[model samples]
Target: LLDGVRGWLMAGAEPLQRLAAMPTQLWRDVSESTRSRSDLENEIALLDQENLLLKGQMQTFWSLQEENRRLRAALNAAQPLEQDLLLAEAIPVKGDARRQFVLVNRGSRDGVFVGQAALVAEGLLGQVLHVGPRTAEILLLSDDTHAVPVRIARTGQRAIAQGTGNGERMEILYLPSNADVKEGDVLVTSGLGGIFPPGYPVATVSAIAEAAGGDFARVSARPLAPVDDVREVLLLWMRDTVSADLPKTDHAP
Candidate 1:
């Protein structure tokens, strides 16, 4: 009877010992699982950061490719031009927003001069205003004080296009109500002022409003040049085709 009682006591104690160890084993398993989950979360965050960086790099690469294409197209356009062309990069000056002028990399040292015509692949850009040693300021077509002598390509009717202090629009002044002007009429430099070369595109008529009983019509035009976004420009050394004794009334302001 004593031996049997001792064996039964041993068996019962073994079960109690296993029951006491259950809490520790459960805590260890939970801790391992939590650590694994935290590590996975950290790895996923790192991957997301890398993905965003790669996307930003891809956008920059695409922008560079587009810029390269535009540069090539500009070069091709300049190849057959009659005037002497000097390639220059332009940067917008930081100042009043209404001032529509840009600083070009070329200047007096590069033979740039005041009143020189500037152009891009699209059309006429502006006229050179001030020239420094290494840079020049170009008065854009959209400056409030700027004006260009333009003629309607369809009828050869002469008129003046004045800047409205707006980059997207210009005003054609002195057009009679019965003038042969219409929407979508192309305006080109008429060689009357002799500042800008003749036959260069200036703007396209966008709107026409006849003033009630007034002599002049209110006409609006959009510049053909990418005035708001042009980065590269060609400074033209136009030949002396027009006489210098020509009237300066139509000259650019």
Candidate 2:
């Protein structure tokens, strides 16, 4: 009878042992599943990073293409001018926003002279302000102190468009209140001051507000050549050509 009771007790102890092991076995399974999920998450993160890098590369490629296209157009436009041209890359100067000045790679050695007009395919950029041995400073048309002689393309009415130190806008100074000007009228260089060539696009009228009890109209326009994004420019050598043609005279003591 005692032996039978001992066998029964042993059978009961076997089930209790299995019950204790159940929690440990379940924990191991959960750990394995968690590790698999973590691996999948890491792979997804790496793929996303790769996709972003590809998108950035594509954007850069398109930007380069557009820059090349503009450069080609600028070269073509310069061919029609009788004067020689020097191609130059625009360099951003520190404090350019306030001074509205840019640096170019051409200088006196390249026949670039002060006051020579800088242009792009779309319109005139500015005049050379300062010259260095290997570089030059350009006074952008958006400089507050700079002014360009411009005319209404439609009616040939002349006016002086002055820079407001703003890259995207210019103001016509002393325009008569009754002037035959309207919004969207194209303004071009009048070739009056002999600075910029005639018929080069400058700006277009954007707004005109009449001065209260005054004869002048407060006119504002947008510049055709905003140099902020342009990569290259044409330096007109017309002034150099003219200087070359002038007869040099010896000075007497």
lDDT of each: 0.80, 0.80
Off by over 4 Å in 1: 1-82, 241-253
Q: What TM-score, computed on C-alpha atoms, does each candidate reach?
A: 0.63, 0.65
Considering summed lDDT, which 10 consecutive residues are worst modelled in model 2?
244-253
Worst 10 residues of 1 by lDDT: 244-253
Clash pairs, candidate 1, are none
Model 2 TM-score is: 0.65
lDDT for model 1: 0.80
Residues 117-179, model 1: lDDT tens digits:
888877778899999978999999989899999889999888999998888999998888889
Clashing pairs in 2: none
List candidate 2 segments past 4 Å from native.
1-81, 239-253
